[model samples]
Target chain A: MVGAGHAGLAMSRCLAVRGIDHVVLERGEVANSWRTERWDSLRLLTPNWQSRLPGFGYEGDDPDGFRDMTQTVAFLQRYAEVISAPVETRTTVTSIRRDDEDYLVTTDRGEWRARSVVLASGACNLANVPKVADALPDGIASVHSFDYRNPDQLPAGGVLVVGASATGTQLGYEIHKSGRPVTLAVGEHIRVPRTYRGRDLMWWMDNAGVHDERWDEMDDINRARRVPSFQLTGTDDGSTLDLNAVTDIGVALVGRFAGLVDGKAQFSGSLLNQCALSDLKMNRLLNSFDEWAAEVGADADVEPSHRLDSTRVPEKPPLTLKLAEAGIGTVLWCTGYRPDLSWLEVDVLDRKGRICHEGGVTSSPGLYLMGMQFLRRRKSALIDGAADDADDLSEHLAAYLDG
Target chain B: MSEATVNNGVNADALVAAREALTEAPQAAQFNWRASCEWKNGTHSHSTVEGFFGLGEEQKRSKTFAFDADHPEIFASEDLGATPVEYVLVGLASCLTAGVAAIAQYRDIQLKSVKATIEGDMDIQGILGIDDEVRNGFDGIKVTYEIDADAGRDDIEALVAQSQKRSAVYDIVTNPTAVTVEVK
Candidate 1:
């Protein structure tokens, strides 16, 4: 195991149960992603009940409630203990190269010759900050969402939070609540309510078997792999951060960030269409929930829809705000992230630089990828699906070892 | 009623008049508000709360406001306006939000918007008489405010702190109050 996150821990447990000897190496402490990448007020997007590993589930009082950063970190640490994952903390891998039929893994601690290597780092190592961030003047401080902790870290001025994903919308909401004006640059995103039909949406999705979707079943697997994150929040009372709510809180909604033109942040005019698309997806999901509820004879009294007034925002919103005049002292880029594999000098990467793998098996003989987005199933990347992915990959590894 | 433009989402002149009356004569603020209600059935009741003033003989009158309360469909009552506990949440939210508005006006800050989400956890076991240990009142209440104004975060925090300090309902919940019951 290359990294000791949830994925790595799950793989370690599965391998251990199968009577395999493996060492889970981590650059930092166990579950370093949850510890270092999460914000101060961050919470698990899924409900507590869905926080299940192979042999353990959430044993807390509030199963329906979401776990905040502290609780989630503690839970991961407990999981590492219960599973007894032999993780060598602070052992950073410097490189991975193919040597004959085996793999040579060189690390800061020492080099290890292994029959197989599992890259369980998962995504979110390198933040995908756009080049436009570099063009901003020295007066404006630019920080990625991963690096952002709170509003106090930012200078006292307006904020232009780009990328209206879960992180972007959340940061926009948090900064706005702190009495700073915010402008959210809208992007393609799936919008789902936090709760629907008197049950958490995670429960509905789980019951609906959305997680069981396989790679082959997808009409366009590549497109599905790049689907935008959901526009939902697990913070403060846990509500949806739809465009309407964001606008209601005085967050200036704009289109995709085109780039800086003459020191002015330029935006495209696609906000209304983006909002419409999100509403469409939300309506479909709500309808699915309603159908499931009716099938289960579940009685839920949700209010009828009162459509958001899009007229509150302009129809063509390709506007620009002068960086200095707009009092925008900071521009926190809540854009998405990509995995960093610069250390792995291998031929398995595709044109998009992603690891070339089917399910969890890579093209290389002794190399396997686990915990990848859409590796085999729809929920493969989530904690709830980590066990299944690990088990499947372990089956492949056992066969390879036997051969 | 005539159409009138409202400024800062508040009637500034009316607020000034009320503030001036309270500041000039503290006794003018000693008006007893009353709520009379009759139960129609289980968990269903009608109430009419009268807002009265004691500023002068002409102001010694009442403005009637009526509403209904009933349990939700999940409970055993007809779905009416809202449950009593929901009403309590509504009161706390509005009182605090109104307090924000008033304080913003006092501070001469241009109010953009104010939003609040008030949540409380209650044990139905107490109301259902299943557990004697649990209290009928809420176990605890949490209020989250998302206020946007022409002020910094510290100012807003101070504003919320001051508002809660001076809020009547907030005081009622946070402090002990004397209540006597008698058949009249």
Candidate 2:
């Protein structure tokens, strides 16, 4: 198996239950990324009920069922032990080679041969920062959302958040509340309520019934080919931070920072437009909340038809910025991240340097990949929802073994 | 947002040159995702072989396309299951599997079928919700590589490293990105 992470350990558990012989290799300790890399405030967006493998349930105190980052790692560690997963921690694989009728995996620890290999290394290994970020003044400190542990780690001055996605929004709220002047860059963000109609997002997800669903119920494959919009209002743990609380807290709202010309931070674009977009999404989310409320037979807290006064972002220019000129000392890039598959010295990849696979099947006959952001399902990437992907993929692997 | 790419000309060359200069300059300006450490510094940089640069030779992609609500499911939205992240996985898996085929062809190993699968976990509240307390992207992703080759386990595992996909999208994603924010 690949790196023993959330997906990897879960896959190992599924395999163990089925009495399948598989080895899980991890560069760090078991569930190390979840334990070490995630922020202290991190929690599962999906509730406790959603983070289960085929035979395991998140049997904890609260069926409200959301867990913090620590709880998550603890659970995964315990699960790894429960199933006796054959995981080798701190054994980073250097290369994967194919010999006569089998596969050989090289790692720092040692070498191992197997009939198949599972790369459970998920997407977090790569931290994506923009090239332009380096253009800022060195005097000003800048950090990605990954490194942000608390507001204390941030500078005393106000912060400018580049991305308006969930991390951007969450960090913006927390840091702003900490009395730091926080400014959030307006990106196209998908707004979903933490509690829709007084129910958790996971409940709504289950009600949507897309989990363990037929692929066709989703949009057509051709339609699925498009990329996704960035999201802004989901929860990290069971609790979702409400943006409504943000503007009330006096965080400086900003437009996309236009190019920093000659070190003077230039800000263009109508900040008001971003407000309008937020209004639209909030309106939509409110409507969704109302619908959910109706589903659960309850009254809605937010009225769907209510409109509010907001500004529009100027069309002439995206928001522009210069670190020194604007007195902006710190920038937090909430922009998204990509994969780190460079060390993988295999060739099933494409000319464009992407792995070729369909529904988890690589171009190579027996090579496989799992646990990507939305790897197999609309819900596959969520913390609580990953086990579903692991179970499904494990079944497929078992099938191949039987064959 | 509209997608943009500078390719196959002085524009692309200048872009690379400008990106390379970013490593030394510590300003958080634009996002640089190149896999080579010749452009190093950030903890986000590919420092280890597992880091960005150790992946593979760069693949100079010449094209990019934008996606939106109109055609939301193609590379962005998770409508029919697949996502840009999944595409990245496919790209990685595909790269390594192709490497397997290449190695087998080069070594005269018996020709046989090969397949691989990958998976990742991302912070939903961070990526999906409009909250800024969380990070914008995934915390850490896990990839599972499966191989079916006629070669022995050692040979196949070694060849898997030959994949260009690891260096391209995966490496780029793994690197740290910088951006500027303006507050009014």
- Superposed on all Cα atoms, the candidates' RMSDs to the truth, in angstroms, are 26.4, 20.5
Writing each residue's lDDT as its tens digit, candidate 1 over A324-361 gives 88899999999988888989987998756888788878
Consecutive 10-residue window with the lowest summed lDDT within model 2 chain A: A310-319
Q: What is the TM-score of each candidate against the true structure?
A: 0.66, 0.61
Model 2 chain B weakest lDDT span, ten residues long: B1-10
Against the true structure, candidate 2 reaches a TM-score of 0.61
**Model 1 residue A73 distance off true place after TM-score fit, in angstroms:** 1.4
The list of candidate 1 runs beyond 4 A from truth reads A236-238, A295-313, A316-318, B1-184
Off by over 4 Å in 2: A211-243, A266-318, B1-184
The window of 10 residues in a row where model 1 chain A has the poorest summed lDDT is A303-312
Task: Report the C-alpha displacement of residue A288, candidate 2, in angstroms.
Answer: 7.0
Question: Which candidate number maximizes DockQ?
Answer: 2
